[model samples]
Structure formats: structure tokens, C-alpha cells
Target: MAKAKPNNKVDPNKYLKNKDIEPEGKLGVAAAVGRMGLMLVGIVGIATEFFRDDGWLKAALGKLFESTSSMMLIPVIIFVLWLLNRWMSSESKSETKKSGDIPMYAMMAVGAYYLFKLITTGSL
Candidate 1:
């Protein structure tokens, strides 16, 4: 009688090669979504500045500032980013961060561009 072949196939372990690696599941999806949101907000801010005026962006930001204390905004953003980074890289065996952190980098770039636009327009 012929022996039946074992059928369960396992994916190659990514952690084996890279000691510190980011996963490609819900964590990646969440990070991508966050980055996309930030990018969209930046695009809208710039569009408002060009199409309408800086008042819309300023009003939107003003409302945000009014609701939350100015001191907490920067700290909260930093904490959130740090938390996400830690959570995403928690599976890695080493302390070193892996490359290909695209979403995070893109989000940061968008934030910088948005701030530059606001500053240049004297909106902030």
C-alpha cells in the first residue's frame, strides 16, 4: 500500500533570517491605514490652502487645539507612534529595528509637508 503524503504546508519563518522583523498582517494593515489617513489629511490641508484659503485648515486645527491642550498633542502623537512601533516589532528576537518601515516613513513625510505648508502660509 502507498503511504498517504502529509498535507499541511507551513510558511517559511520570516524571523529565522531577520532577528528583528516587522510582520505583514493586521499590524501592517493598521499601520498602512494610519499612514493613508495622515496622507489624506495633508492633501486636504494643502488643497484647502490653494483652492479656498488657509482659514479652513486653521479653523479645523483651532478646533482641535481648543479641545485638547497644546502640550499634549506632540506627546500623544509621539507616544502613539512609539507604541505602534513596539507592538509591530515585538515578535523580533533582537532589539534592532528592521528595514522597510514604509508606512511610518510616508506618514512622517506627509506630516512634515503639511506643517511646512501651514508654516509657509503663516497659518500656524
Candidate 2:
């Protein structure tokens, strides 16, 4: 009896085997340009505010709030980003993941606390 040959055949013209999928160098340049554009817009906004004839002190205090708001938002943003990345990377599509909810809930609780405090203190 003749031995049967194993079927290991694959199509050579598949999309994965195509040579036209090379990474473009312009992608990095486009990313850098986008970042620079954001930076320029931010600088322009700040300059317009600072050079205005209105209250300089209030402008300065507004800057302080901007920085403080960003600091307060950083952890929440990080938690959300982590949760999204984890969900995206999970292999079990049918089952839902629940690892990152605690941080998000905690952040919300903290925000509610601050909001309540502000309202109680007549600062809101």
C-alpha cells in the first residue's frame, strides 16, 4: 500500500503574502505634525488669553485651574485607557472582562465627593 501525502498546500497569492503592505515612512512624519499642530494651537490660545486687556490675575488663576483640572483628570484618563486596552486585547470575545472597573468607580466616587464639597462650600 502507498503512503498518503499530507496536505500542506497554501495559496501563494494571499493578502498576507502580498509585498504591497510595506510600512510607510510618512506615518511617523504625520504623527509628529499632528502633535506639533496641537502644541501650536495650545500656545496660540494661551497667548491670546495672556495678551488680552482683561484681568491678568483672573487669567493667571484660570491657568492654575487648567493645570489642576488636568492633574485631577490624569488618573481617570489612565484608568479608562487601561480598561479599553485590556478589553481590546482580551481573547474571550463572548465573556466580558471586569478587571478595571474598580478604578473607574473609585474615580467617579472621588469626583462626586469633590462636587458635593464644592456645592456645600458655595464654590460651585
Candidate 3:
């Protein structure tokens, strides 16, 4: 009796149909950029405080929050970024694009407001 050869090849159509597989390249790059930006911000802020002559602890805390509005804005920025990332990483093809894209636009509006405020008042 002859031995049957085992199937070693995966069907491309079936592989593509599997929703569990995430598309590569751009997804990883976006995550890397976000992480690097956060690290760079932290490093700059820490270096600034370390090089200053004033009381580091109090000044660092004060500069971190700045004010109630600034403190609130921090979480909102984080949430918006996370939401956008999740939406981008979703593998669902049937999802309607228009239903969940509002956060980015809303963030843009908030960003514009902050930029205008900074320009006019010289402070955020």
C-alpha cells in the first residue's frame, strides 16, 4: 500500500476568510509611533524638571496637571486615541465607516479651540 501525502498547503481563500488574523505593517507602525511619542514627551518633561533649579517635586506636579481643565483634557485625549486605534484595528469588513468616526472630528474641534486659545492668550 502506498502512503498518502499529507496536505501541507493552506488555502489562501480560507486563510483570508479567517477574521482572527490582523493585517500587518501599518498597524504595528502606528502603535510604535504612539509609544515613541509618549516616551519622548516623558523624557522631555523629566529632563526639563531635572535641569531646573527650583523645587522639583512641587513644580513637576503643578506643571503636570496645570489646571482642572488641562487635567480633564488629558484623559479625553487618551480615550480618543484609544478609540481611534481600536476602530482602525478592527477586522470587520461589514462595519459602517460613518457610524464611529465622530471622535476624531470632535478631537479636531477641541484641538482647534486649544490652538486658537493658545495663539490669542499665549497660554493653553
TM-score of each: 0.29, 0.28, 0.30
Model 3: weakest 10-residue lDDT segment is: 38-47
Q: Quick one: ranking by lDDT, best first?
A: 1, 3, 2
Q: What's the CA error at residue 89 for candidate 3, in Å?
A: 12
What TM-score does structure 2 among the candidates reach?
0.28
Tens-digit lDDT track for model 3 on 14-52?
A: 756677876769979997665555445445444555567
Instruction: Pick the lDDT winner.
Output: 1
Worst 10 residues of 1 by lDDT: 95-104
Which pairs of residues have clashing backbones in candidate 2? none
Candidate 2 C-alpha lDDT tens digits along 12-122: 776666676767589888976655554454444445555777746576556656876756766787899987787645567776557545544554454455456556895
CA deviation > 4 Å runs, candidate 3: 1-7, 10-96
Decoy 1 TM-score against native: 0.29
Top candidate on TM-score is 3
Give the number of colliding residue pairs in candidate 1.
0
Candidate 1 per-residue lDDT, tens place, 1-124, comes to 9999998888679457786776689988998877776677666665766456546667766766886577478788889998877756746576545443655576568666877767789662
Q: What is the C-alpha RMSD of each candidate to the true structure, in Å?
A: 16.0, 16.5, 11.7
Candidate 1's error at 2, in angstroms? Answer: 49
Sort all candidates by TM-score, best to worst: 3, 1, 2
